[model samples]
Target: MSKGLTRRSMIAGSAASVLAAPALAQELPDTVQIRESLSSTTRRNTASFRAIQWRAHFPNLRNGAILVDIDSRALHLWQEDGGYHVYPSSVPQSAEMTRKGRTRVVRKVVGPTWRPTPNMRRRNPEWPAVVEPGPNNPLGTHALYLSWTYYRIHGTHDTRKIGRRSSSGCIGLYNEHIAEVFGMTKIGTQVLLI
Candidate 1:
């Protein structure tokens, strides 16, 4: 071994250089590129996932609060004790299908059966009137029924729906996420869709 270097040192240095090479090869973005990306629609959409104060939307946590941001496709929950959680969600397919305002969780159902609304049936004449609780059920494994007749915060088996505007009117979360939310929420949990 040399006075200042050894086989171990050489091997470690070589490994460090190899690990750093890809990072070094990548060029840093210019100011213009950074500015353009910041202003892009994608950035605007993703920026919606940022944390929001519960007080801005809710008068009080009461039983708890669930805030669904339609534009950002995100759901936020604030428990009465100040616990906070956020999840990516699926919103209504279009503005016409969206119902915005305050509502409460009127019911919580596990292994929920789904029934299409009259309007849903009218829109898709071929669609089934009843869907039993199963993998094919649009409601997934859990649902929190809203005060509004046809609106719900539920789970979707179709994961691609989350973080996108793909629901008929309900807010949809991944099944596992919904199950977790289901356990956290109560029948009177406050909900606001905006």
Candidate 2:
């Protein structure tokens, strides 16, 4: 073959080989930005539990947290960046333990008053003549007030009965854990139960 024709043939063969290769065989397009996670310094602050003295020996738990697993009767506190603490929980005998939606934080109030809902009243006619917030309240030492429908993750006065089916539809944490969490979390954080 003529030298010029040979050069053209080689160029055509090279082009065909390049086109036949898998798309992924080539370097990623410049438009695709490869992202790296934040440095250690940028990780979420390990929540402080200074006010809850009982946790002095326990390590500070991770990022944005989580709670409740109906099937397991376990409450898991998860951090957004990745870490979790699991504790046994209790669900109500009458209350269904299904997690319907996203998880969020219990940002405010400890030892919240128990104002039994009209439904709660209907269930237990003698629930309370009038409810008030204090240590004597069934809510125990802490209640994590969530953003959706009057729900909370709290400590129950009855600790011996945890890890079973038994609350009015709130996620129950140990009193000590709730106090620590109540101090660390803030309003408007994400919460999920599954």
Candidate 3:
């Protein structure tokens, strides 16, 4: 074996900083790298799965569509090769998550501050009125605002809540996963909440 960087090194080093892409390595975020598989590992059991066995042949959506599959609790970033990027998500209750229409990405922000909605405040008056951008913020690292009223796709401080019905009404992802999606998605991107 040689002492130089090899293809195997890059794949194995995906999680660590030793793939040795020196200059470009500095630009890599500490966030989780994109999954080469369609499924995800649950933080709860580590060994257990969330049944995200999707193949990403987006039935109706095209390559550019962002499909948030509530049933699968997985978000698929439609790709040109019929293989999509999968991100685990914590969806709102079925009734609350279904917007019954197509919406477009309205705004995108990094390190978004989270201000409790009036409804959220009414539900929990003791909750803080606002949370500044930080590791503790409800909207972790980044957010993608939807055209629909108060709905958004954002990161969460608690990754354990992902792959379940945990969010008030918006979709939630692990901070790292949200970072990947936020970077790939752009304004005017079609969002189907179904």
Cα lDDT for residue 143, candidate 1 = 95
Q: Tell me the TM-score of each prediction against the true structure.
A: 0.76, 0.60, 0.67
RMSD of 1: 12.3
- The Cα RMSD of model 3 versus the native structure comes to 8.7
- Backbone clashes, each candidate: 0, 14, 0
The candidates, ranked best first by lDDT, are 1, 3, 2
lDDT string, candidate 1, 115-137, tens digits: 99999999899999899999999
In model 2, the number of clashes is 14
- In model 3, what are the clashing residue pairs, if there are any? none
Worst 10 residues of 1 by lDDT: 28-37
| Model 2 weakest 10-residue run by lDDT | 45-54
Where does candidate 1 clash, by residue pair? none
C-alpha positional error of residue 79 in candidate 2 after TM-score superposition, expressed in Å:
3.1
Q: Report every candidate's CA lDDT.
A: 0.80, 0.56, 0.68
Better of 2 and 3 by lDDT: 3
The best candidate in terms of TM-score: 1
List where candidate 1 sits over 4 angstroms from the true fold.
1-48
Model 2: residues with Cα > 4 Å off, grouped in runs: 1-63, 80-83, 94-99
